[model samples]
Target chain A: MTKKKLIYIILFLAPFAFIFLSLFVGRYPLSVPEVARILWGKLIFSAWGLQDISTTIVWDIRLPRAILGALVGGSLAVSGAAFQGLFRNPLVSSGILGVSSGAGFGAALAILLFNTTSYIYIFAFCFGGMAVLFSFLIGKIYNTTPTIMLVLGGVIVSSVFSALISFAKYVADPYNQLPAITFWLMGSLASARYQDIMVAGVPMLLGIAGLIAVRWRINILSMGDREAHTLGLNTALSKGIVVICATLATAGAVCVSGIIGWVGLVIPHIGRMLVGNDNKILIPTSLALGACFLILVDNLGRVISGSEIPLGILTALVGGPFFVYLLKKTKGGGW
Target chain B: MPLVEVSNAGFGYNGRAIFKNINLEVREGEVFCIVGPNGCGKTTFLDCLLGLLKLDQGDILLGGRNIKTIRPPDVAKVLAYVPQSHQKTFPYTVMEIVLMGRASYTGIFSSPSPADISIAEEALAIVGLQEYRNRPYTQLSGGEGQLVMIARALAQKTPVIIMDEPTAHLDFKHELTVLETMVQLVRNTGKSVIMATHFPNHAFYFENNDVPTSVALMDKLTFSVIGRPGEVLSEKNLKSLYRINARVVSYQLDHNTEVKQIIPISTLYSKESERVN
Candidate 1:
């Protein structure tokens, strides 16, 4: 029990440590005392006369990016863990409900029509939410929303939105809109700002908090509907809560982070290995571990090349091989 | 008063009647066993009694209240259910699985408390799986899984437990072990067990008990006969129910002990066809 508590302590603190580390290692790298002086909240220059550029770089640029990374990463990971439990499939991730495709299509359409960046977040969030609504309405074609029906609904909605995205891409301006849509679809956290936190990050925080608050029930939800019912669960209500929370998290995340994947798919599996399948603990652990992972990876992305490598590329690059190794080591018994 | 009562109970799908006009009641501290052939609505009947399926033409009462009137959590406090088997995708611990039975007692957004944990531990002790609490549920043998399920049911602390073919996949020794566990549960805890099984001998095992016992035979889609095991389990009834030519042989093992057995000689096979379908 003490060992488990120690693990919880470390996981809880890992993200903060990484975020702190990130504040010092940006393009305009600030030294430890210099960064600490800026963080100490006094604009006054020290005896060494640290430049205003250092303060602006650390406070305005790096802090928001790292915090946004933590929020997006935590949102995706928690929602992914919750969806896996609700759908009763280990391979299920945050985008299984068509949110990413919907958001991707919305971003492409906005790029094609308006040729501006301001409406992109709103369109992406709206369409992402609508896609999940379509999936939910399709699931309601039957008397009750069975997990199988929900999954099929998700598949149908996802394919429709993905085809729409392709259509938008085919007609976009070859020079300007095409590249813009392509980059948004590839996903990067480089555009993260405090305003992004005010807009999309609020929903992300709500989702993470909701999932963590109601996480213990995922254990009962994973036992299948009938068994959970027999065990006295209001399965419909429980499933509704999980679906709503996960959708909010995914849509809000896609709003700011573009179309990042793999973090949602792999972080929860890693969390399961660390904490077992008990969502009660795994949800919070996923939140913390996901924050740490994305910040570190985003820092790597920033420094890996002269031009920024998109986070979607980096996460998949790292996550795919690591998942293969996990599969081979555990022989598909990692959960 | 009976703990569970059903009157004129009927259920069906797509407006097709499966069974109707059934009447039965289970008392406290009694062992109630239902025996039937394949696809004879035994599981359907149990599902209706457990309130999973809505009864089309009748009502079931738990603790003298209509089952429909009681919420699912309230019904859970009065009755528990054990499935024939479960296929687990995630590797939840046995203790975690058993603690799931406390769901009714806990709040929706909360987990099991220390009190709930102790209750689960006691239930594991009842099923003789105390030392296996930390084991993964997916790795256990079939019989052990069934026992773990029973522990989960026991943790609910319900007065009545409903099981559907709790021993269908077990070997001879494991079957007897589960059967003994069920009987002992009734004898010691005074909790009524309502189970449906394919074996008539399973009902016979509940014979010679000091507590009240009921053996019910459901057949011919609508016909059901409930009585004492010795009174209802006759050779003629077995033949009519299962089309089996069987003998009920009683061996006097001692002055006060008589071992009753049902040995099937042949399947009548519709009594007219020489070809097997």
Candidate 2:
């Protein structure tokens, strides 16, 4: 590997090391050896008799939350990379097609009207399906593949969902559900559980794998629709499949842990800048870097304030200015 | 049998007719050049042949069958196209880009086979871009990029190769190089090549080659003359198509010299009467 590749691998691997250390070395400190023993013992026999309190804190609380954070972060980044390639625009993210807002609306509706069991997962899938359907419909109606139409469709659908969410908020009792809705919108992995992991992890993992497998096709599509078709690709069908797959992954992540922004938009750009624009390299690199980025951010959220900060706030705080700097540097040339 | 046939074909977009009542046939092992003014439906016609655009009126027969009835993959198996210019957003290498031409042959999940790789390499060598195989396609110069596009078409290994303005942005040397490559491709492989260009001099040069020949010169709006080079590329025809009073310049062959005559229509004159009182 080149020096740059080596450095990126080190940079990406660093955060996992820090997170592993931080998991045990907190306010209730456990030695690194004890942490290792706990992990190994749990893997083999399911009970490490060192301390019940440490087990609960490490396995029950922090571990699932951290894993959820990594899953969501990686899904968003991979989705963004696929979207950027599909639309041939560097600035696009998973949210460019109204996916997040649509999922938020579906979750809000489920919370308000259905109030049924496991409504979060249901709402997420429904919203994602609807967003993809609308995006395709709008693209078809326009008869053009210009990115502007997709963005406009996203904005319009997002506005509709935002209005619905606002209405739901107004009618919501200010005591319980209102707080839940607000917190969910703000985005957190604080309430993450083992069940959440199973629901979100499977689809996110599948999505990331699918994107990697189709990475070369995505690069061909980035050349434009005509070139792709002439290259013996069924451009429309392939694009639709990719969009649906990406939305499924994003929705799965958002179902468990609300709308965590910026990781999707920022990490892929960083991946491209560091590794160059080949999707074969960029996809895997984005996954690793995204996982690390979110873990570090989540750890910072935990450490800096003595109480956990919402992941959305932390991501925006870090991603916003960095995005501006990248914009300035690229000067919109690659788009 | 003719390799490609357009039987009274008509095509239009959004109800605006671009071309109507057009008919042409390209035989095997011929360099058929279509030349016309801007917006004269040259690219649109090529699109129809490639099945990218549906014809409004008639049928295009490829290999003596209606193109619409043939599966797209099957059409791709026999015909390949090189676009005028391609925009590069991702950094794919020249090898990767050329390998994409083999997509019709390769399975969906399988990588390009050894055969595919060798074909791509052969294409690169033919286009004189073998040394640039590993270079990022976006970093190539315009002429080099055009050559790579040709390489990609060649990699398809199809019997019929269609090109749209393959030398549009090329300099003088590259222009001659592309035309020369096309001539050699037809001569060596007996592949039918159809290309649309603004320059008719290229057609004149190709027709002068010592091979069984078929050539056509098409002008804007409705004029076509198809025959041997000396008959079709007369000064009257050249002046009419280009709308310039051109003097035909010929160079006699010295001993052991094989270069043919070249006509340079350098200046164009306005329409005026040459009246006798």
Candidate 3:
């Protein structure tokens, strides 16, 4: 491997390893060899009768949570990377397109208006994603420039949805539905199961794969629509495909994990800073780094205190200030 | 036969008609120069040829086929264009920007092939920018950037190259260098060259060199003077075309003893009546 490739691999893998080990090590310290043996036994042999509680902890609880963390992280990061390229602005994220607000409104509507269970969260996410997609399509039909008008349309859509969410909160049975809405917005991996992973994993993986396949084209498209079209690329079609893929990926993640903040916005920027702006490298590296960053943050949330903090809080706590610092540094120098 | 033919082409933006009843033909292996004042629809005409703008009336035919029938990729294979200037916002290497010319040929998912690299290198060599290939394009001088744009057009390997004010940003020496390279491309490769420029002197220079060139001077909508060097570059023709009296003066170079021409517009008008007296 090239030195740069090796460095990125190490940087990407080390955090994953640390998070994996930390998951089993805190309050119930299992040796690396022991954890390895437990994982191997569970995989290669049907050894349900293993002696150590380490097997149960790693297999049943932490493993599903870790996988879920990776899925959510990878989805957010890849989506963020694609959006940044689409807008030609590194600051653009999933939230800019009203995906989060739409998802939040969907979830809130399900909980408050319909009094639905967590099972309806996925529906909410899909509805939210579709809302944003519809807005974008309408804007395009009217010949709106994707940069300014599309973003403004998203903001408008998000505000209307936000008011709906507030209205739903007001009408909701405060004791029953309000807490569920709040908890979903805070986001967590505490309730993750293997089934939850299965629900979210398919779309996330598929979206990331599609983005990777078209990453080079995305880079070319970043030059602006006129240049891209002159180069014989169907700029409109390519952009539509990318936006849909990113939306599906993010929607799947938000459905399962609620509105986890910062990973989508910050991970791609971090990936760019680490490996440079070539999307060929940035896409995959963002996926790996995002998975690692979130897994590490989620694990920290698990063990940092007597009680588990929300994954959303942990990421915001870490990514928020770091983002500010990056902003300050890049103030004089344009990113 | 003409390689590109625009018959009675009319275009407008947002219901504002800019030009109407425009007719032009660009033949192969010849340099066609389009000269007009600012905003005479020169760039708009080029845009129409490239299918960047849709024409409200008439047809544009390439190789006797309507442009609408040809796919964008096929059109790209036949015609390459270099804009007046490109905004290099990102930090792409000169080679990387040049390599983007192969986008039409490469597969959607595949990297550029070795043949693409070779073509790009050859283009860079043609523009005298071989050594600067690895340098960041944004860091290059204005002249070098202009050359890089030409190199990109050359890399397309198209039969016809269209440039809108290719030398607009270059100094005098670089302007000459770019024009010389363009003329060489037409002469050696048998590629047709179409360029738009404000400088009438360039058209005179090309014509005086016995190069295969045609000059078209746009005066107003549907009014133009088109002919060979001396036929269309007379003082009366230029005065009518530019709405200013101008003297076309010829001078012999010291070293080469070649005839050079200059169009002095501002001062020549005052001297016209004096010379008449």
Using TM-score as the measure, which candidate wins?
A: 1
Off by over 4 Å in 1: A42-51, A326-335, B208-211, B269-277
On the 0 to 100 scale, the lDDT of residue A34 in model 1 is 85
> DockQ of candidates 1 onward, in order?
0.71, 0.36, 0.39
- TM-score: model 3 vs. ground truth: 0.89
Local distance difference test, each candidate: 0.88, 0.77, 0.79
Q: How does chain B of model 2 score on TM-score?
A: 0.89
Across residues A1-335, which tens digit of lDDT does each residue of candidate 1 receive? 99999999999999999989999776776789988878875455445444588877887889999999999899999999999999999889999989999999998988888866668998999999999999999998997999999999999999999999999989988899888999999888888788988898878988888888789889988999888888998888989989988989989989888988988888888888777888998999999988888898899889978989888899888778887887777765534
What TM-score, computed on C-alpha atoms, does each candidate reach?
Answer: 0.96, 0.87, 0.89
Model 1, position A272, has a per-residue lDDT of 80
What is candidate 1's lDDT per residue for B1-277, written digit by digit as tens? 8899998888888988788888888998898988989999998988888878899998898878999999889888888999977878899999999999999999977889999999999999999999999988988988999999999999999999999999988999889889888988998999999999998888777785444778889886664688988888998898889888788888887888777778877788655323422
Model 2 CA lDDT for position A228: 71
Better of 1 and 3 by lDDT: 1
Could you tell me which 10 consecutive residues in candidate 2 chain A have the lowest summed lDDT? A18-27
Give DockQ: model 3.
Answer: 0.39
Decreasing TM-score order of the candidates: 1, 3, 2
Off by over 4 Å in 3: A8-19, A25-27, A47-52, A114-118, A143-148, A320-335, B208-210, B254-264, B267-277
lDDT (Cα, tens digit) per residue for candidate 2, span A1-335 = 68977877776676576557557634577776767777777778774465578777887777777788778888889889989888888778888888888878777777776655388678866886697678767866768555557667777777877898899889987887787777777777777789888877888888877787777677767867777767777777668667877887788877777888998888988877666776767877888778777877777787777787898899989877876787688753233
RMSD of each: 2.7, 3.8, 3.4
Instruction: Give the distance in Å from residue B275's predicted Cα in candidate 3 to where it truly belongs.
Output: 11
TM-scores of the first chain across all predictions?
Answer: 0.95, 0.89, 0.90
